[model samples]
Target: MADENGETRRQRNERFEFISPELQVPDGITHVWDWFWQLSGRRHSGPEALTFADVGEWSRLLGIEVLPEEVQMLMAMDDQYLRAVREDQRAARERAQQQ
Candidate 1:
């Protein structure tokens, strides 16, 4: 992640891609997903409670790694490493204001 490191990035990407079709989950987990999503998204302005270790441990105790994304997500949540994605959502809206 230090500068434009392509080789390092590729290997990191491969770890999460190794999950098989059986590991993929359906839409049922969306409710829980949304809850975690909202919590991580508000890290800066929110109450600043519950470390990522807490969330990851809870997910682990439940013994569910049904999706590749879920595996990557829970792993990252253990270390506050979520938001690896640079979502252009709000950024896209802000850029349009200048145009």
Candidate 2:
């Protein structure tokens, strides 16, 4: 199925891999991910620095009301993503050192 933006579900999932596939509300999650990605320059630091007020501002800017649970989900996803990236970076550094 395609979203309103004509993006197929698979494409959307690929684009926003940080979002959980089990989410019943993928569209809202995608929006939140997109906004967070933009806010953070696609870096882990962006989500790490977010405050509750920033989330409220995000709601106002996106015109989408997100529940607190949704926010928690997003935060958890961000943490997981950050950890994965860090692990990948560490492996790359180790490989470079070995070479």
Candidate 3:
């Protein structure tokens, strides 16, 4: 059902707020979230290596530090899950743009 804002609850729930580029490690965001956001942006930018090492290097380049446990969890997500997340984020972004 649509909310008062005319956006469906599902759409609101599916929305993934894009973190500002300036904040390398935004407050209240987990390491996995940061990693996923970077990965998603990279996937959009162009074809690139998708490896744990690459993630680590990216974090370093961004001046963000990710714990080992966080890296492990990020790497644990299989391709299917990652793709689903990317699609959902993209859809939410499109919806937001329309508003």
Candidate 4:
């Protein structure tokens, strides 16, 4: 279902919200998110694709230096999101098998 803003709950939840009091980077999070999607190939690939060299490449491409901590945070979040998606898929398959 969509909200008054016409954005579905899933879309809203999937929206990237960076709320870090520390590690304040002047750049917007969307850049990082987009770069990540491009790097990961829209989640068709795994987090293993997010390597230190790739992070450096992102920094160079963006013309800004990304801190190591920030890259770590992004990788961690990606891993967690992928794990949740896998679990959800597994549950859906089990339910379908049951029916």
lDDT of each: 0.49, 0.62, 0.62, 0.61
Considering every candidate listed, which one attains the maximal TM-score? 2
Which parts of model 3 are misplaced by more than 4 Å? 1-31, 44-49, 78-99
Give the per-residue lDDT of model 3 (tens digit) for 1-99: 244467744566567453423536556655576567567566533323368777777888989787787776666643545565567568768979999
lDDT of 4 by residue, 13-75 (tens): 568463424435446576666656565663334334456676677579868767677688778
Can you tell me which runs of candidate 4 are displaced by over 4 Å? 1-49
Residue 36 miss distance in model 1 (angstroms): 2.0
* Alpha-carbon runs more than 4 Å astray in model 1: 1-25, 45-50, 53-83, 86-99
* Weakest 10 consecutive residues of candidate 2 by summed lDDT: 39-48
Off by over 4 Å in 2: 1-51
Q: Residue 90 of candidate 2: its Cα lDDT?
A: 78
Better of 1 and 3 by lDDT: 3
Candidate 4's TM-score? 0.49
lDDT of 2 by residue, 1-99 (tens): 233467654575578685645636477467666665554553434225455676677678878778878778667766776675566557657968999
By TM-score, how accurate is candidate 3? 0.42
Q: Lowest lDDT 10-mer window, candidate 3?
A: 16-25
Model 1 worst lDDT run, 10 consecutive residues:
1-10
Model 1 clash pairs?
none
The TM-scores of all predictions, comma-separated, are 0.27, 0.52, 0.42, 0.49
Backbone clashes, each candidate? 0, 0, 0, 0
**Could you arrange the candidates by TM-score from highest to lowest?**
2, 4, 3, 1
lDDT of 1 by residue, 1-99 (tens): 221334333354466585333334448766455646554654563234446564565557766444557555544553453243233234435767979
